[model samples]
Target: MTATDVLFIDDDAAIRQAIQQTLQLEELTTETFDNAASALKILRPDFQGVVLCDFHMPGINGLDLLKAVQQIDESIPVIILTGQGDIGTAVTAMQLGAYDFIEKPFNQDELIELLKHALEKRHLALENRVLKAQLRIFARPGPRLLGGESPKMKRVLSMLENLVDTSADILLSGETGAGKDAIARYIHETSERSQHNFVAINCGAVPENLIESELFGHEAGAFTGAEKKRIGKFEHANKGTIFLDELESMPLALQVRLLRVLEERKVERLGSNVSIGLDVRIIAATKSDLKSKSERGEFREDLYYRLNVIQIDIPPLRERREDIHLLFHHFALIAAARYGRESIPLNKQQIGLLLQHDWPGNVRELRNRAERYVLMGPVALDEIQSAASVDTPTPQSLSDMVDAFERSMIQNALQMCQGSIKDTMEYLGLARKTLYDKMKKHGLDKAQFKEDADHDGL
Candidate 1:
């Protein structure tokens, strides 16, 4: 355990001096209080150390001092050092929240060991409190996952509803910012484990060196700074769901450990021999193509297969154009509430501008734009055109300008339909063959546009 600030309370100066000298080797800061009244005056709630008080003091006994300390903050562990061997009184002290009791002439080794154990317990207790507080922030509904009148969306919601009963693993895949975490939370909230806990850990966020201990825990003395045996996310989410966002970023070595837990229903903490059972349902999400990664040897094939049991691919916001208006309205409403303003309108020009741009960052980008819209009002069309012109190729020749204009017109139409060739052709009043020729001349991949349209089930 970490060396902590310790306090010793006893009227016997010799005993106090002995304890102070013994603990000095451990580099623990110690304060000696000759009486309970003096100890009370110095005791503060922020003290992380344990208190060692003699059972019999001049005025208040050890049990009474423990009670007083607990009333201020029950978290601090109190150790009672008594000369008598009374089990009944010891039981009473235990009932009163005394951490542990030691008979007089306590061995330095034994005393140090008990103090280390008490410190570990205190550390875990404090950590749990902080984790619970952070969880409360995510307890409320997150950013909106709006839109679903299309068959694809309806089916997605139906699948989510079905998942509310079973403890089956769920896999979500799509472009970045597609709101995969939102769907994961929806399933967790509607599931039987809602009352337990829903722990979300981003595999891509943490450093590779620490990921294993973060997932499966670590034993005391396992490594440097492993002052105490720590409970990892798996044990923390014992009876609940564990959402692993960006699961593809997990290292192969860690993936092997994870696969074993998923298969054997148990996990062993790092540097520990014993295997502890787990009852957590895993929900893994990835923006990258896991199948591709598996084939490329970047991700484990068996792990991919395990996680892909119940897959739900969320379409990007650009593909799900029908949901654009709904998402915009939702985001606008949130912005209005946050800013304490009335409803702001997105006029026809604003709507047309939104329909023309391709959202590379998906729903997250769209929500950001909507919030920007609420704050900045409608953006100038000429400014957008000027921005577009800087990136797009400009031709000096009249013939080339005409060709560029034609390509730009077709591209705008394609973006409006989120790259649906059929819709683009219909909007442009052009034949499929002509659209094909124009796309070929512009060096465009017609298939890529068609893929997004098909992915959205357009």
Candidate 2:
């Protein structure tokens, strides 16, 4: 809404004409009316802008017009124009819901300023309605796949579809790059709450000090720089889903608050007197060994039990060798589209090499490698390893570090030959039985695990 559509009602044609000319110079759209009755007919809830009317009209007076406009829609601010020495009438107009009273022989500057303020308020009200409408679209289900249709991926999709309708809190456990977030998204997109928000927050990415406030919001003066009230994730996720990634990285204090919310169905916003009710279905994901963390007293035991009510451990890309070709094709096509280039198909050797490497960083690492390959031809083994290593932070102590390094190398060799001991040994420059012995020593299982009916033992 703009001040360009200002409507002026006055019995005198000259006065109405004068006001319109003056407003026209200010780049306003003006409509002059000799009678208030005709003006009321044109006035609507969708009126473009301000309504300026004369106080001493013959039929319906300024006060009567203001009352009628208010009856139609109270949101519209009606300004009453009075003649000189009509101070009592202007006061009466203000009492009767007139936004402002302008005396005749009014300064053009004053009228323009008042009209401008009213137009801004009207514009903001309309903008807020548009914004709320946009939010409704985001609350709906988002796109679910990057690509791929291998048997392994089919099983994952099957599991997601099976679990989507339930109200269970899912715990997605996987390696850092294993696409746990992708699986989480798939569940949310296919679930009953698909029409609601699916908000994701990285537990590890946020600083520990501000994590609580970021998740649960704060009131004005909650702390330094807390100048205004804020809504929290739990509140924002009402009747929706909240994905807490890197769940183990959340501080113990926050873990307690989260557990309480899960158990009691509410949360207390910081620096507030009251607790807010929440209806968010939580889907927490972790890349680390949560059992180990629980044992180390780094993660809360009660919280883990609560979250692990329905756990889904995602296998690394190397473990699902059959899916490599599918993943490669998926990434390749995505890369081509993103880079605006013709899609390039991978050779048998390229697929073989892709399957052979141990993707420590998981699906995310594979996607990055695919993008690199698309941009700069085939990537070298060292370059790919360096890329994966960027997220797989190095271990500190020598003994622990060496063990991790050895595990990675052995895992790579095993994956290279589809778990063939002889081929794996040749790749690792070791004997067949020696490779088997190392596999046993490292507690690496060669058995092919499948998602069974008793998968969660529920």
Candidate 3:
């Protein structure tokens, strides 16, 4: 669990010192403030902690500080610490939204127990807020792809939008977990056929013997265990979309049938002479090169041509490294909601580790890690560090080395400036246009850098 810091504010230096020692013994992370004004400076709406303020102070006493803290984030638990026989003041503090009041010369065990409860309340409140925000994101028009202003993603989205209303079959090419299925769903959602069913089947996962029946239904008594007529994916997706994931894994015999269906806009059920016309659009995705497979007789060249009418290639996560922070936070927020925890922001070192590591599993791997981090914070950090330390071949070409250095420098500058393009350009001593050109070339986005810094206080 991620620890929440406690802000202890008291006017008396001796009181602050004593409480600090007590809190340390309790193994609670805390910050001491001599005055309420100083304490309020560090208070923020997103602060993950509780505030403990002295009831009577020279300036801006506990009651007033409570109000200020409420204005920032009413959910934050602010406990009032008062002197002995201050029951009236403590009661008044509770009415004004103070979590609980503890009288000085307070029992150490009771105070610790109260602090633990307050911290738990604060943690729950933060998790609720995160969940609500995630719901708002989901309640938007369509499924989100979680892309920032990176040029590569923007272009891909643009292409998808352009093909949304078209009936042409789409072939999505990218590494595994690059969100080809998501892109397919997005196309279906934004298209005119969204009201109809959108069927999906993993070509590689289905048994070769049953793949044909799965794609184009089996009639009654078609084969053994074919007791009744059933609708296939293609028929079920009539006037909608059918996504064939891992298209390269489809059997060669099935490829011929798929091509015929694409050409004739119809399908024949197993053991049935009648052909059913289809108004469904097809979206095929593959991690392998279908053209190369076709050349090697592993896949049909005619079928490849049929599906490749409108190809959409999704860039892997490594190619669009600048969006890593943004994507990580997006998935982290989701994980936070799923696991009922607050999303831990990645520090500069963590972000650097993410950028340095080669994501062989792509966006899916990043998302899984984000969930793990939400569930087990520092443990995920150790895993990332370990991954970063793995040995990889160094760039042998001078141009490749220069490019690597340039990308790293740009990332460093962006990190330093918190993703402000103007500040980053100034820090890097480059013209705005030059910085933009380089950023575009390297698939870097300044906004994402700033977001990363803001997320974890980098």
231: Cα error in model 1, Å: 1.2
Question: What C-alpha root-mean-square deviation, in Å, does candidate 3 show against the real structure?
Answer: 11.1
Task: Estimate the TM-score for candidate 3.
Answer: 0.62
TM-score of each: 0.54, 0.52, 0.62
Note each model's CA RMSD in angstroms. 27.6, 25.1, 11.1
Query: Where is model 3 poorest over a 10-residue stretch in terms of lDDT?
Result: 449-458
Ranking by lDDT: 3, 1, 2
- Compose the digit string of candidate 2's lDDT tens values, residues 38-131: 9889777655467888888898988888888988766677888887767797898788777888887889999988986776565545434443
Pairs of colliding residues, candidate 1: none
Candidate 1 lDDT over 116-148, as tens digits, reads 677657654654454354345334756424445
Residue pair clashes in candidate 2: 4-29, 177-363
Name the candidate that leads on lDDT.
Answer: 3
- Runs in model 3 deviating more than 4 A are 1-144, 393-458
